[model samples]
Target: MVSRKTLAGAVAVVGLLVSAQGANALSIKEALAATYQNNPTLNASRAQLRATDEGVPQALAGWRPTITASGRYGYSWENQRGTYFEHANYAASISVTQPLFRGFRTVNSTRQAESIVRAQREDLRVAEQNALFQAATSYMDVIRDTALVSLRRSDLKFQEEQVRASKDRFNVGEGTRTDVSQAESGRARAQSALNTSLANLNTSRAIFRQVIGIDPKNLSARTNVTSLLPKTVSSAISIGQEEHPSIQSSLFMVDAAQFAVKTAQGVLLPSADLLGEASLTDSNATGNLGPESRSATIYGRVTIPIYQSGSEYSAVRQAKEDLGRTEILVDVSRDSIRAQAISSWGQLNASIASITAAEAQVAAARLALEGVIEEQRVGQRTTLDVLDTQSDLVDARVTLVTAQRDRVVAAYQVLSSIGRLDYDNLGLSGARYDPTEHYRLVRDKWIGLRTPDGR
Candidate 1:
């Protein structure tokens, strides 16, 4: 039979293994920071925001003067009255046009661009939150699966010893062959469970790498975000409606669409501009006639739209329709964010409750298993009873691990739902991403081929 001291030694070894793993653990904050800095999807969103920033300068360009320069040179030969003649002419001119009025198109277009940029900034925030949440989920999954694998392996070891004990008893006629066969079956099942747990651990690790841009290394147990969550679901939904990135982005979109309607309306109005031109021309004649001339002129011009095949009117109607759509989308975004907040809040609460229940279950199962083992030693319980109790203990440990993981992941989900899963709120230490800096750099910039950082 397996000695009690041997079983205790095995348990101590497993505890030491767990302790060693904890000693080199990575914190959730460090994982989130790595994800924020390296996640491909989040970085792509940042790049997209930078692209949107150019719209402001494009709209502002409408207010600036346009200058054009042209030069032409030509040689010609002609026969007149049976006499051959050759002439060469060269001309160069520069023209400038500055818009004095464009029916407020520039103003409305600039406003629209500004609103769109702000919307894109919110979009980036959404991406950041999503990436961080995914990273946190994957991190917790790894931890959970790793613990389950360890538990399964330990269970398998105990079952292997049980099988040996049963065989030794049967050889001495103290136990039946049925007891040996049952122990062997239990050991095989434990091995299968361990294999499954290992496979799950590998899958979780792959997800961790994909989300965080690095393989998980000694990940520590993550602290629950209960301290960061709102006290009530109603409060969470309220915060979500007010601060969620999706809702904020949609609100900005509505503003942009409204300005778009104004810009489209401006297209129907007259445009006025100041125009100036300067030119130089040189001409040579074969009959000893050559001349050079220079001229400069400045004038104000107005262009009144008379007919455009109803295109301008159609554009105005389209803009109005778009405005209506955007206004409706704002409400849609609000509803979706609110729903997410409520669902996540419920999940967080459920997981917390589950953790508490699982803890109690683990304690009860541990005591039951110890009682069964002692009863078996006293010949009051069969070997199968002891094996069954050990299996129950392993199952209880697995449930506890899963509940812990769920609690951590659900907490992050709640934060994400309310739009608080960000570096600032989490107090993560790193270079904070600021979209406004790029916008300010390019908003009023008249001319630049390079970005703010010279990229």
Candidate 2:
């Protein structure tokens, strides 16, 4: 029977192991959604987008009539015949000022605000797309490292078997000391590879945690290799140009700049304003019985841009220059999108080819290793030959795993280039964690994109 202390120790050990497992168990989809929802960088960008929603109200200000109220109170006193009297007067009035015209400035400014709002939305989209790309890349990296670790472990097992075989053969005088030494060296190298792979896996997991706010040690789902290759580069580029968030955001900016130019030009024209005011006042002096007064004013004012030290002209010119710059930037963005799509498309295909070749190489290496082992058994191959072949097999497996992971990641990269790597395209549908849900909840409220409970 176990003592109480031993039972307690065993329970503690089990608890620790369970805690460790829980800490590492995160799936790729979970990580992706968590990062998209909770990542500070992405959330900050969402807030920025919501902040931009205020532009509409600001622009609407130009088109709305403004009302203001004013009030004043005063007390006056004068001494006469050694007697004193005091009086107080209060007046209040409300006025409305309507801008009838401003060289279309109000209209143009409103349009500029609309363009800016659209641009900000595109900016948010770009941010989301980039975050998804980074999260996906890190997820694949961890998977690749994990695969390498498995490969190293298998190699070590194979080498250990070889060492056992060599020991038995040497005991029977059928193998030399060199055979045993070679097997030992092979096992050591395998152990080193295993250690390297483990370290790399840890590093990848750390980055994954940093990005998605979760450790992914339990994310063991295999990537579907069959779905990794795209059908055509032209199709990819076309989709990317149409949907890529960066290009879309840049295009929106170009439109906004165009509107700004119009608004600036409108500043060179005449403007009309309607102003009115009314006031009531009362005053009493020590000698006088009492005093009272009233006043009122109403007028329509039209101001034409006579001159402004060339500042208005300079603004118009500067806006035109800005429009020109934005037009060029749009073209530049188009070219950049095309280049990225094409480059990633090419890499996707290259990775596919490399994976196929690596698979073939792995098969050939395994066969060669087996042949070298047989030759060593028959005294036709040196111990080093067997060890070298074993090393080649390990390298072949490593290359295959790398190629496969790259191919899978490249597929996503291609999708990312085309801006199609979103939840819908990826089929992350149904009651899944929706990052945009939070944005929608507070979008119409004055507080904007934040929960009432202040998450």
Among these predictions, the greatest TM-score belongs to 1
Clashes of each: 0, 0
Tens digit per residue, CA lDDT, model 1, 190-289: 9999899899989999999999998899877646467899989999999999899999999999999999999999988999999999999998988676
Could you tell me how far off, in angstroms, the CA of residue 148 lies in candidate 1 after the best superposition? 0.9
- Per-residue lDDT of 281 in model 2: 65
Q: Provide the TM-score for each candidate, comma-separated.
A: 0.93, 0.81
lDDT of 1: 0.86
* Model 2 lDDT tens row, 1-455: 11233222322321211122344566556666777766678878877776666665566677667888988888867677988878776778878898888788777777777677777777776676688778878887887787677667766777777788888888999888988998899899889988998999899988887777777766643444236435788887787778777787787788888778888888888889999887776666555656676778889999888888898889989988988888888778778878988988888778879877876887787678767766776789877787787688677667766776676677767877777766556654234444345445543444344444474
Residue ranges of candidate 2 with Cα displaced over 4 Å: 1-36, 74-91, 160-185, 217-230, 286-289, 430-455
Taking all chains together, the TM-score of candidate 1 against the true structure is: 0.93
Question: For candidate 2, what is the TM-score?
Answer: 0.81
- In angstroms, the error of model 1 at 293 is 2.7
Every candidate's lDDT = 0.86, 0.72
